[model samples]
Target: MDYKYIEQLLERYWACETSLQEEQILRTFFQQQEVPEHLMAYKAIFDVQQEQAEATLGEEFDERILEMIEGDPVKAIPLRGGLRRRSFLRPLYQAAGLVALILTIGIAAQHSFDEEGQSQHTQFAQTDSLERPADEFVTVPETQEAAVTVEQDSINLTR
Candidate 1:
């Protein structure tokens, strides 16, 4: 019949001045079957609010969710044996390989150059020795007869 109080409460609600109790009263008044024509427009809104307030999750729902969480746990990888140790030693192995390669190359180069050097040294000694005067060359004798001959030659040269 009279909607003066409802109209006043709605005005306060629109103005952001209604208390929680006043809002509850408004929601309860709208739940009636024969709502005033002008207020019928607001019934749908209050009904949805009431439905949402009454909706809730049961204990069985919570139990099922907990069981699912406990059923499939995250698995951790094992780092036993030499799996992790080998990772740290990987650089050491690489350095050792590098040193072995350098040494191999160095020794090969030295041997290759040393062969050429020996041939050059022998050629230079033969040619240069033959070009020098025989009197300037001193000879060492290994036998007694050769030593005596060398001494007699030196004595004759001194004379």
Candidate 2:
């Protein structure tokens, strides 16, 4: 048989125009008892291609990849160097502290308001008790005046 057709297919194969069937045809034709002298140069290339096409990556490949990875040095984290503490309850602690600070401020403000009102009321009562018109809304009650008079009498007695 003339090797003309095989030579044309090999030419197309090199030019990247041959179909898969044509490539298989060329591979089959080359494996004959004797290849044409000129085509002999490509025998080893085609035989290697055929062998590689039948090959698959297997457990040996996985083992080799793992061994290469395991051979590298492991990275270490420093105990006190740039690491921050992580806690699930840190937000709760912050919120509790914020609440305590706010409550303290609120209680302080309330106390200041109460003290101001009490001081104002005591000043008003002292002024009213000293002397006031009979028709005023806050004329001194007789009972409160009597208590003051009693305290003064006690002081006079002690003297």
Candidate 3:
């Protein structure tokens, strides 16, 4: 028999241009016992397709799968009342901690400022005690006349 049609179909099949009906025809042609010697190499391919087409899952397939899945039941974790309460108050606890931290920092900064202000006040008091009155007499050196000058007048002029 002339195999020009089958050869043409095989070419179209390899090029992926065959219709489903054309492919079925090729499978049927290759399934025959007397495939030509030139086309014998492709016969095994069609035989495997026919075998796979005839294959069927057993009746117990679904039952076996369901048994395997149900064999080990997943345990559910029960939520406790204390865990729920803690989760709900988590944000409140965080806010309270933040407030306590801020208050601690504020109190520390206030104490530091108070200590610095007290030290500055003490320094100012000490300097004020050591300062001489501007009205007191200041002696001139012997290079000039021995004059007991009023220091307040010179201090006022400089100011």
Candidate 4:
């Protein structure tokens, strides 16, 4: 019946000057069953907002959502000696740590084996460089005399 007042309030609302009470009055006026045809467009917006405001979920909603996400029932296990809550990611952290440890060990073992192989190659090269051919052997007269004297001393000791 008095659409003039509602129009004035809407103008103030669009200009960002309407108070909260005035906005509430506008909403309440739109909620009436017999809305004017000219104001029918705004009626839908307020009606949808009211419906959304009234929509609610039951107490089991969170449990159902958690079950759907985790594929199992979630339980709050209490800590034994601490007051703080433990995180659900603790197991994931442990698993990641185990994987990191295994990877580190594997990498270290691989590096160690590589170093051993390299050292063995180096040792072999050094030994090869130090080795002489059989033809390079030469006998000296002093060595022969020393050998004979050593043999004679051994014979004297046996006697």
RMSD in angstroms between candidate 4 and the native structure over all alpha carbons: 23.3
The residue ranges of model 1 lying beyond 4 angstroms of the native Cα positions read 65-159
How high a TM-score does candidate 1 get? 0.40
How accurate locally, in lDDT, is each candidate? 0.57, 0.56, 0.56, 0.56
* Model 1 poorest ten-residue lDDT run: 135-144
> RMSD of model 1, in Å?
26.5
Residues 1-159 of candidate 4 have per-residue lDDT tens digits of: 678999999889889999999989988998999899988998898899899999899979988777677663244443453323234444544444444334333433443455554333333322332231111222123233333443444344346
Most accurate candidate by lDDT = 1
Question: For residues 29-59, what per-residue lDDT tens digits would candidate 3 score against the true structure?
Answer: 9978999998988888889889999999997
lDDT of 1: 0.57
lDDT: worst 10-residue window of model 2 = 134-143
The alpha-carbon lDDT assigned to residue 93 of candidate 4 equals 43
lDDT of 4 at 158: 43
Q: lDDT: which is higher, 1 or 3? A: 1
Q: How many clashes show up per model?
A: 0, 0, 0, 0
TM-score for each of the candidates:
0.40, 0.35, 0.40, 0.39
Looking at candidate 1, what is the lDDT of residue 76?
A: 34
lDDT of 3 at 38: 88
